[model samples]
Target chain A: MTSIRRRQVIAGLAMAPFISRYPLASKILGRLVIIGGGFAGATLARFAKALEPRLGVTLIEARSRYTACPMSNLVLAGERELNQQTFDYKALAEAGVQVIQDYAVDVDGAQQRVILQGGERVEYDRLVLAPGVQLNFDQLSGYSRQGAQDMPHAWQAGAQTTLLRRQLQAMPDDGLAIISVPPAPYRCPPGPYERASLMASYFKQAKPKARILILDSNDRFSKQALFQQGWQDLYGDTIRWQSASNDGRVNRVEPASMRVHTDFDTYQPDVANIIPPQQAGDIAHRAGVTDSSGWCPVESVSFESNRQPNIHVIGDAAIAAPMPKSAFAANAQAKVCAIALVRLFRGIRPEPTVLANTCYSYLKPGHAISIAGAYRTDNGEFSAIAAASGASPIDATQALRQQEAAHAADWFSAIIQETFG
Target chain B: MGRYHAILPMLVLGLTPCGYAQGAPSALSQSASQAAVCSGCHGKLSGVAVPALVSDARVLEQQMLALRQEGGDSAMHRLIHAYDETQIRGIAEALASQKNPPAAQSTGP
Candidate 1:
C-alpha cells in the first residue's frame, strides 16, 4: 500500500472497534429515590428528570399538598392568600417522577430500598432527603400539640397560619399580642423576625393601639436592622422587641389560658405565637443518618451525609452552612447535590460546586430588605466565600426598599416556579 | 478517526451489555453476556465513588434521574449531562443486575 493509504488503513483498524462499541450504551444507568416533597425534593426531581428521561425517579411526600413556608406568614398579615403558597404533585408527574403521597417509614440503605408507611417497598440506587424541619416543642415546657391549636406558631405554613389569622382578627382595639421567637440555628433564621415585622404593619392600621410584644430567646436575630427600621417607621412605639435579658422575655406559654410571662409580669393576650426549637425530622435520624446533635452531618460541599453513602441530605435536615435555613439555600444545595449524583453515575469526577443564596424580607407594600451570600466547597467544607455578603442597610431609603422589594418578589417567584411549578 | 475514540466509550457504555468488549464490542443478547459487562466495572474501590451499581436495576434508574440536572444535583452535573436518556437508563439496568459486595465504601454524603 502507498504510505498515505497505509496510515489511513491503520487508523481505520483502530476506528473499527469504536464504531462497533457506540451502539451498546443504553441500559446501564442507576436510579434515584428522593424523600420529602418540599423545595429540595421537588426541585431535584424536576432537574434530574429533565436531564435524563430514563432515570427512574420516585418522590415520596408525607403530605398531599405543599404549602410554602417562605410566604406563609403573609397569610396572617393578609398580604397573600393560603392558595398562593400551596402546590400539588402534578409538576413532579409532568417531569416523569412517580409521586407517592405516602410517608416514608424506613430507609433500609443496606437493602437499597425504602419501606413506606403503607408497607410498600420501593428500591433506589441513590437517596436524597429533604424531609425539612422537626419542631422541638418538647424542648419548651408547657408546649404541646394540643396547645398549638389555641396558640398557633404559624410555623408550618398551612392551618397554623389560618388559625393565627383568625385569632388576630378576633382581637379588639388596644388588645395585647405576643410572639415568641425561637433560639438560633432553626429553619428560616429570619422567619420569626419577619413575622413580627409583618404583624406590626398589620396592627398599625386595624387596631393602632394593639401592642405587639416580641419575646425573643436570643439577643441577635435575622434581618435585625431592616425589621427594626420597619417597625420604627411603620408601627413606632406600638411594637416592642424584648431580648433574653429584657424583663418581658418569654419563658413559656400557657396556651389554654392565652397567657405568656417573664420574670416580673404576666400578660393574658388575645393571641400568642409560640414558635419552638427545631431539629432534623424523624425520618433522617431514624435512618441513622444523623449524629447526637439532632442534625444530619454531611460532607459540606457535596452535601452528602457522613452516616451513609448513596444517601444525600439537603434542606433543613442537613447541616449546610454558612447558608441560613431558607428555601433559597435548599434550592442551591439541590443543584450541587444533583451534579454529585450524576458524576458518580457516569464514572467521572465532579467539578467543585459553588452555590449562592439571597433572602429578602418584605416590610410593606413596596418596602423590602435583603441579605445575599455565595458559597463553595474548599478542603471538603462548604463555607461562605463572599466576604461582602450581608443584609441591605438598616435605614434604607424608600427608593432602595422599593427596588429590593421588586427584586425580592421576582427572586421568590422564580425560585418557587423552579421548585414546584 | 482517533478523535472519535473519546466519544465512542460513551456510545458503547451501556449499549449492548455491561462488559461485552473483551476484544472489541459485540451484541450481547443473553442476560449472561449482560451480566458479564455489569461485573466488569462495579464494586471494590470502583472508579465511580457512588454506591456500587451492583446490578440493582431499580436503584440505578432513580440515581440516574437524581444526577441528571441541577435540582437533581450539581456534583455530577456535567458528566451526567453528557449521556442521552436511553444510555443513562441502560446503564442503570445493566449495572443493577450485578451482585454488589455486602457494603461498598463511599466518600460523600
Candidate 2:
C-alpha cells in the first residue's frame, strides 16, 4: 500500500471512537430524491448511490428521453442528428436508482415531499433540483410558446432544432439568416456564437451566396475576440455581427413574415433563431427556492437552498456565478453536492469544496475553441481562481483548433456516457 | 471492501484537524471530487484524442506541476493553475487508485 493509504488507515483507526459516538452511525440514511435527469441530477444520483449504497436514491424526470443542448447546434448545421443528441434514463434506472417518469408539479419543502402531476407524493429526507433554464417568452414582444414554432429558438434542442435546420435548407441561395441573441445570464454563454459559426459554415458550403447576421443584445460576448478572428479567417464577408449599441438588440419579431425588429431597423430574414430570455425552471419557483432574479441561491459548498432547508439546487437553475451554466459545470457541482449530502446524512459537517468547468465551442467541423475556469468557495460564495481561468488564444494555430475540436467531441461522448450510459 | 476503502479515506480526512477547523475539505476529498470534472473530457474510451487519466501518480503530478508553471493559454494549463502542489498530488494519487474511473469515450454522439 502507498503512504497515503497507510496514513488514511491510521487516521481511520484514530477516528473509530468518534465514529462510535456519532448519533446516526447505526441508523439507515433516508431517501434522496432528485428532480430532473440532466447532467446535474443524473450524475448526482449515480455518484451519491455509489458513495453510500445505503442511501435510497430516486430520479424524477418529466421526459422519458432527454435531448442534450450542448451539441444540438451541430444538429442545426447538419453535422449531427437530433437522435444523436438524445438519451434515455434506462441506464440510470439500471444503476439501482428508482427512475420516475412524471412531471414534478410542486415541492413541499415543509413536509419534505414532492407532488407529482398524477397526485403521487414522493417523500424524501433530502431533495435536489437540477431543473435547467426555462425560456421566458413573455419577456419578448410578439413571441410566445406558439410563436416559437414559426421562428424557432431551437435553444432546448429536439423538434425546434429540426424546424430551424429544415427552414435553413429551404432558403434561397442569396437569402439572409439572422440569429438573435438574448442578454447576459442565458443557458450557455458561448452557445449563440457557436451556433452562428456553425450556421455560417453550413451556408458557406451549401449556399455560397447566402449571408448570416448576428444581432446581440449584449455589447460583448464570451470569447469575442477569438470568434471575430475565426469569422475573419474561416468565412470572411459571409457573416456580420451587430452589438446592442449598434441597434442589434432585438425587441420584437413577426414570425408570420419572418420580420425581426431592432431599435433602428427591421429585416425580414429567411430564417430567424430568436433565443428568448430565461429563468430557473418553474418548479424552483413553486418550491419557494427562487429569489427575485428568477434563479435559486444556494450555499456554494453544499448547494443547499438558501431559501429553504434540506433542499439543494444545482445546474442551470442555481445562481453559480463565475461558473457558466454548462454541462461540465453541472457535472462538477453534482459531484461536490453528492459528497456534501453523503457527509450530511452521516451527521458530519460538510466540507468546503472546489469546482471546475471547461466549455468547447466548435468553429467548424473538426475545428473548435474552448474556455476553462476553476472556482472555490470563499466567504460563503464561489469566486473564480483568476490564475487558472481563460479561453483559447485568439491567435491559436489551426492544428490546436483541430485538436480542441477533437477534445470537444471527446468531451461530449464522455459526458454522455457518464450521465446517461 | 472496495466501498469501505473509498469511504474510509474520506471519513478520516473529514475528521482530521486540518479539515475540521476551517471546514476546508482535505486535499484527498477535494482532489477526488475535482478529478471527476476531468472525466468530462478525458475518458478511457478508444478513438479519443484527449489522454485518459491513467498515468503513474508521480508522473502525473510532475507533468501537472510543469504545465501549471508553463503559463500557456491552453485549457489544461489554465485549469491546472487552480491547484497547489498538495492538491495536485492528491488528485494524481486518487485517480491512480481508482478501480473504475468516471467516464468512457465513444464515437460521435
Candidate 3:
C-alpha cells in the first residue's frame, strides 16, 4: 500500500483536518465501494483504513478465495502447490474492511451504487473497480468454456492451474506438451515463457524424453534472451519456441483431437495450455468504463476512469501501459488511487503520482530473471523513467542469478504479507 | 467543486513553512508519499536483495542524487526523478525513523 508515505499523509491529515473548515459538512470523506477484491481492491481497502480509520471501505468479491496468478506458474510445474498461491479476505475483514462475499453484477455510475447479483444495492461516495481480465475464448476456434475444462488456460488460477498440472503429470515420458501464448497485453507478459521454462524443468526431471513446445503470437516476448539462454543451458532443444513471424500464431485449437492449428500448420500434442486473448473483467463493460481497446482508460494521476467520474480502475483491467499488468503493479496503483481519494475527500488536490513495478520470472529453481522500473505522471501519463527501468542483464553471473531467485522468493513473501498478512 | 474552492486558500496557507512546528524531526514526521514508492521494492517487507532505505537522511539523499545523476536511464535513475530534493529528504527521513520502530506485522485483515 506504499505504507510509509500513506501513513504520513494520514497522520498529517489527522493533525490538520482541512475538511473541518467546512463546518456544516461533518464527514467530507464518506463511503468507498470497491469491486473485484484481488490485489488492487484488497490493498485499496486496507490502505484506505490505514490512512484514515474513519473512512468506510467495503470490498465486494464474487469468490470466497483468490488464487493469485502471479506465482501460479510454479504450481503448474509442480514446484509449488495451489495452496501457496491462495488467499482469502479474512485479514482484510479483521482490518475493518467490510468484505462482502458476493458478485457485483452491475455498476450504476450515475447513482454511485454497485448492484449485486442478489438484488442488493451497495452505494458509496466513491467507487473503485479492480476486476482482473476476462479471457476471450471465442478468439480461438474450438475453444470455449467447456473446452477450457479439458485444455485449461490456467490464466485465472485455482482449478485451471490444478487441471493443467494434472494433465502434465499424466502425460507419457516421450509426450509432447505445447503452451500456446496469445498476443501482447495478456495477463502476465513473461508468464507463458516462465511456464515453458518450468515445464521444461519438470519434464527434464520426471519425463526425460518429453519435449516442451511454445507457440507464440508475438514476434518477441519479455526477457526473451535470458529465457532462451536458460532454456539452452538447462534443457537444450528439449524446449522449442516458434515466434509469430514463423507461423507461431495458433489460429485454432481442437481440444477433442488434442491439436492446435497455427497459420501454417497443425500439430498434435499430449497436452496443451492455450492462454487466450483477454479483455477487462465483465463488470467494466457493464459500467461503460472500457474503451474500444477492451481496457479501462484511467486518468494517470488518480486511476479514475476517464469515461466515468469518481470510478477508478486498477490492476490488469486498467490500461496503465509501460507498466505491465502484474500483481506488484496493481499493488502500487492501489496505493496511489487510495491516496488520491483521501486527498479529494479532504478537498485537497491529488499529489503527483509515482508508481513502480518489479517482475521476477524463474528459469529453474535456483535461477531467475527480472524487470523493474519507477514511473511518474508529471505529464498525466505513466512511463518508465528511461534511467529507472530495465530487465536483468543478459550476461549475469550464476551467483547473481541465484541471488535474484532468492529476491524473487522474498518479493513473493513480502507482497503477500503486505497485501493479506 | 464548491468544497474544493473553499479549501484552496487553506491548502495554500498550509504549504507555508509555518504550518508545521519547528524542530519536528524530519524522518518520522515527514510525509511518506515520495519515500513510500521506494518501500514497495526496497523495504524490509519487499525482501529483494536491494538495501532497505532505512538509513540517515543525508546518506540516503546522496545515494538518490547519485542515482539521479549517474543512473542514466537505468531503473534507479528513473525512480529517483519522481522527487525533488525536499521530497527525497522527506522520504529518507521517514524511512530512517521507521528503522527503529519495527514495521507492523501483517496478519488477517
Model 1 residue B87 CA deviation in Å: 30
Runs with alpha carbons beyond 4 Å of true place in candidate 3: A1-28, B1-31, B39-56, B59-87, B97-109
Top lDDT model: 2
Between candidates 2 and 3, the lDDT winner: 2
lDDT of 1 by residue, A254-341 (tens): 8888888777778888889998888888889877798887889888655778989889999889887787888877776775566566
For candidate 3, write residues B1-109 as lDDT tens digits.
Answer: 2221221111111111111223433211224444444423322222212233323456655655655565432233345565677866665554444432212332211
Lowest lDDT 10-mer window, candidate 3 chain A?
A16-25
Write model 2 residue lDDT over A132-183, tens digit each, in one string.
9899999989998898988999988888999999999999999999999998
Docking class of 3: incorrect
Comparison by lDDT, 1 against 2, better one = 2
Candidate achieving the largest DockQ: 2
**Model 1, residue A52: displacement in angstroms?**
2.6
Writing each residue's lDDT as its tens digit, candidate 3 over A163-222 gives 999999999999999999999888883399989998898998999999988999999987
What TM-score results for chain B when candidate 1 is compared with the true chain B? 0.39
